[model samples]
Target: MSTLANETYEARVVAASEPGVTFSGALSSEWIKFRTLRSSWAVLLAAVVALVAIAGLIGYVTGSKWDGQLDPEDRVASAPLQGLFLAQLLIGVLGVLFVSGEYTTGMIRSTLAAVPRRLPVLWAKGVVYGLVTLSTLIPTTFLAYGVAQLFLSHFGHSTSLSAPTAFRAVLATGIYLALVGLLGSALGWIVRSTPGGISLLVGLLLIVPVLLEVVPGQWAKDISHYLPSAAGASFYSSLQADGALSPGAGLLVLVIWVAVATTVAAFLLKRRDG
Candidate 1:
């Protein structure tokens, strides 16, 4: 072929390949990486099992002695979703590993090379992980609720899904967990160290809340409601606890936290060398 013909062919090829690193491509890449990780599957399975087991235990124990031992208020508020406390920790750790594992292994350099624009990688990771968490956990939450209610029904204490806020509460539990997973992913990207990311996540969700309790009176009450875990808890609570934000407000607060973390991660990702 002549030089002009060869050049024309090369230009067409380059143009065709230029779109390879697009947002959709990045999302697909991230999804593959996420699903291939053995640790990811293990953590997800563990979260589901723990959620179901804990809820079942609560149901069984409550139902066994419902007539005389259970309080009326407790029966009414019995969501058996305490398992989520454990699920959060497991899923959060999975999120930390999602990014930090790649960093620790030096895989991030290649990842950035493929998606030089940088921010798409962050967005892809956040969206993929969040969707995975939400899809898996939402159904699990419903199953757990069903199993728990089955046991509780023996004692005439089961609440219906049609009960006020019941369906919303179940749905919100999944949303809260998905947000938590994304928050953890952002922390992982920012810290780039497994231990560091996990520590920060734990402190934000658990330790900080405890530390705030040391503050006296209204100050603690005023501040604690905005913490990530507290805000998330409000979503699934049939009745908002005193000093806690309402469900809508709580969801907004948690979204802000996720957004802030993502923004910081994206900034650092662009500014720092991979």
Candidate 2:
């Protein structure tokens, strides 16, 4: 056999001889995979830039156009978070591709070969990606907040982070976005197909909210407010629009959503051959 085949055999034999896949080992392996991938870094960087730059642009436009008409709390609360609309899609799709790409390339077999128990692989992926996302975006959230505030500050409408609600909006911006990406990651595991996963995530985050508009009832309105994007806005949105959830309830809604999706994906992963 060729050298490549011999190395593959040796690796498999080592994996087979091991007592079990340690969670820490799985996490380290996943971290290597996620960090080394150029696409992961590229997408993450793009998300950060989108959040910060677009925030500045929006701030500039609003500050220039509205002059002093914009409310201080409203300006700081909502304007900075405007970038999440695009940034969420970027990170969410990145979440999907992080898993489904391995499947697409037939690398999942090798991954599972290294971790026969399977669940650790999924757990490690989610944990690693989620931490990376959360860490990166928390600072990005602040940067976005600062950039937008720079513009609004000139117009005397910007609020400090120390303001009662400003920190909630800023912190929730990152937490909300991190959950969106986690949701996409879970969907990736569930779907296991790139296109299907992407479609499902987009449909859930974007299309579903719009579709609810035509449902025509108090129930529809009620459910609409609970949907991922709207729920996210409740905490991150300084305006606190009518019908939106409270900040705490919004966080719970998103956490529950992520938990459900991840649990379902874990169950399906354990049962399916793929």
Give each model a TM-score.
Answer: 0.92, 0.90
Instruction: Provide the overall lDDT of each model, using Cα atoms, as 2-decimal numbers.
Output: 0.88, 0.88
List candidate 1 segments past 4 Å from native: 1-13, 17-19, 71-73
Candidate 2: TM-score?
0.90
Model 2: worst 10 consecutive residues (lDDT sum): 6-15
Could you tell me the lDDT of residue 105 within candidate 1?
A: 97
Model 1 TM-score, 2 decimals: 0.92
Candidate 2 regions exceeding 4 Å error are: 1-20, 68-76
Tens-place lDDT per residue, model 1, 235-255, is 777777887899999999999
Residue pairs clashing, model 1: none
Candidate 2: Cα lDDT at 246? 92
Per-candidate clash tally: 0, 0
Q: What is the lDDT of residue 149 in candidate 1?
A: 92
Best by lDDT: 2
